[model samples]
Target: MSEPKSYIQVLSPELLGRVFDAYAHKPDEEKHLIGLETTLFSSCESGFYANPVILSHVSKNWRNISLDRPTLWSTMIMVRPIASHIPKVENWLERSKTAPLTLQIMQTIPDDDTPIEPLREERTAVNTILEMLLKHIERWEAITFFLCIGFLPAFAEFPQGKLDQLKSATLNLATWSTHPQVVDRVFRAIHAAPELEFVSWCASFFQTGLPDHVPWQQLKRIELDVNDISEEPSSVGYVLDILSKCPQLTSAKFILGFCKTTTPKALNTPLNLPNLRSLALDEASSPNIAYVLQNLTLPSLHTLNLSLFSDEERSSANLFKAVGSLVGRSKSTLKYLGLDIDDEQLLKLLPFAKDVEVLRVGGAKTKKFTSLLTRNANNKISLEVLPKLEYLHLTYAQDAMRPHRISASTAALNRMVVFRTSQPPATPGLKKLKFISVGTAASSFQTAHITLILGTYSHLNLKSVRFEGN
Candidate 1:
């Protein structure tokens, strides 16, 4: 025993906490220390062990000790054909002999139409579980049903319905035209939900006009890809109506639409909101169509994302006159702006070049689209050069390499929009260069960029670097 004289290092605070937890026989009062660790992965917002997977390793003894907890097994997430999830959920149900379980049904869309899980058996098995979940939907915290079948939910009933059952969810349908059930399910889900507070996405359609009584009052955000939004994008009136009603609404986006007329300055509404922070819209509108913007201002507005959805019906000359008259003013209040031009007609028509420090426009119709950019940017003149601008990003799908190089960036070729400085973005106020993103002829990543966009860093000391593109 006297030979046991050896060094004993002091345990760190982290180690001591772990040791205490390992020895503590926590009972039912511990909200987090549940017995079942076989199922469920939640966030801090989800209110439980943030990551349940770690509990499997609290020592070999815990491998099966925690698997018997039923409330712990009450929720399940089905992501793919990862066959393991089935057995795990099944085992938990069998062992715990549990109460009604909450199941999250999520299906991923294949990039191409190559039957997502080439393994037919996996697909079949997954579908079986999906049908089971739908049938066994007795008790639930909220429905997080991810739809991959073939339709978008059409909530015939607005905010209050039994079929629109959801607490928080994200549903996406890339092409809902061919699928009727997809839309039907989406509508049912929307109708069933009481207050949907999360993200919703629907793209590629001829039109999208939901029922008048949308669950918009509690919505924090809504993204509608108005199909066939010509110069007069459909649903703007409805969308704006929702905004005017929902004081909690903060973010809005419209992917494609036709502008039949210009937006009015008053938006033809008498309501007022002092908390609007993010707005992104672009399409055709009546020439006299205006928002109550001049009358009601977004004192908290942080981002504005607007783009021209379709330019086919627009006449070059008429568009010039129309764009020339279209304008927005709040004393340089917006932090970010994105614009798309079908032809050079847009640039020739609008006064946007000098308005915002961060600008992005697509010359979809012709390379000559940037001609206005070239003309405006000549003579060392930077009108829209944001004195507090930290980044200037641009991409020309139709245009090739730029005619002239921007001297602002040393790593210009490697970057999407290079910085005025070469050092890493250590200073919060300095411009940060990002990797260039270019899509090809086949896989066009147009709208996808919105989800991954690196917005303007709100820094007051930033400046716009001279930029030019072909």
Candidate 2:
């Protein structure tokens, strides 16, 4: 006997489509508020397919409705290359129609750590899938690919005219080892993307390959990870050359492995990035960063993130000096500052950022930081150190791991909040406070003190308080 369909399944196509559309557009509070990161789960996992895919398999009516909804299939997420799933990929493209697309392709390796070359069947399937996607390249709005370098040739084979609508792209190359011909071909293909606004290229490329193919002046956001560059000295030149070409870049982030300074002539040359609003420099202890900062003139910069990681003490001294010089050369127009330095270093630099309204501290304690927000003995806060700050974001957590310092930090935080709220006219109070605790105990925060502060500051328009635990 056949099972009868329920009332929900028997609804009209229009009504069903409306329901699904509403569900798709609903604000995902959990993802945003809770800081939920997107994870690439393997197909062997139970819940591989998301809502649209699962809905199509419900009944005949639902399947028809889902197929008709073009928006439902515009965003396709693939775990890896699977021969059997080619049919599904084809169906998604057919249903997507002419709508703009967002594709995320995660190329995962086998469980046995075997090379993908031996997997002929999977390789063939992947090639077929890539061809189909290339056929519809005009509809690519945002694309993220984590694929092997072997696929570079396949990408280069595609025609350039098809990438008219491409806007954002993230390419996580599997290997840094690539031939010059392949690199040039790949960059040439990317250069054809006229509307490309955001690009994240996390791989090593020869310095000479840049500024030739890519339209650097058209890009607004760029993130580069050049950890595999062979020569340390050439890395600085590579960054400077790219920066020189990108005058229209509004936001840029660099992840450098080796720390080396630029040449004297390079440092002497002044580069003006008028449109740059935000810049982040993440290096593994490089004095070169300081020299780079000293040479550039960023008139529009408002947000700066400097995350320099090194084992030895005093590695960040040169960086700090460079930053101070940069701030002095540029106007004190910064509104937001994010730092990953230790206590003493941050204290030394906060005075230069007096105009900063929002501050985000990562990988450091908030204990000494609270002093910056506090009023001195004369009941007057220093006008030269974060005096206009209204938003505070702490990326570190007070937990059992650091039992000795946790209580002190908590107390300092409490006092800072209390002092700021009470002396509003003399010192601007924080209007919003956010805490991000990743892989840590969320319960470590003092709920009683937070509640009391909220209750006390209810009249000061201090309503936004967020504690994000991921």
Which number leads on lDDT? 2
Instruction: State in Å the error of residue 31, model 2.
Output: 6.8
lDDT of 1 by residue, 164-206 (tens): 3444554444445576445555555564556566545444223
Q: Tell me the lDDT of candidate 2.
A: 0.63
- Say which candidate scores most in TM-score: 2
Cα lDDT for residue 95, candidate 2: 83
TM-scores of the candidates in the order shown: 0.51, 0.74
Report the Cα lDDT for residue 462, model 1: 33
Q: What tens-digit string does per-residue lDDT give for candidate 2 at 1-470?
A: 99998788677888888787665544443433211122332211121334477777877778888888998777776665577668877887888899898887766544456665645555566677778888888899888776653444456555756778889887755353455555555556666788888876655353443335567879898887665433344546566777898878999888765545433455665678888899887753436566578788888889998765643423545566777777777663788888765566777778777678788765555566677766453644343456666777665355322221222355576666655544444444423333222213232454554444345444443446565443
Model 2 CA RMSD to the hidden true structure, in angstroms? 6.8
Which segments of candidate 2 are over 4 A away from where they belong?
A: 1-50, 53-69, 81-85, 109-125, 149-156, 174-183, 204-211, 229-237, 261-266, 284-286, 313-321, 375-378, 382-384, 397-408, 426-465
TM-score computed on alpha carbons, candidate 2: 0.74
- Model 2 residue 149 CA deviation (Å) reads 7.6
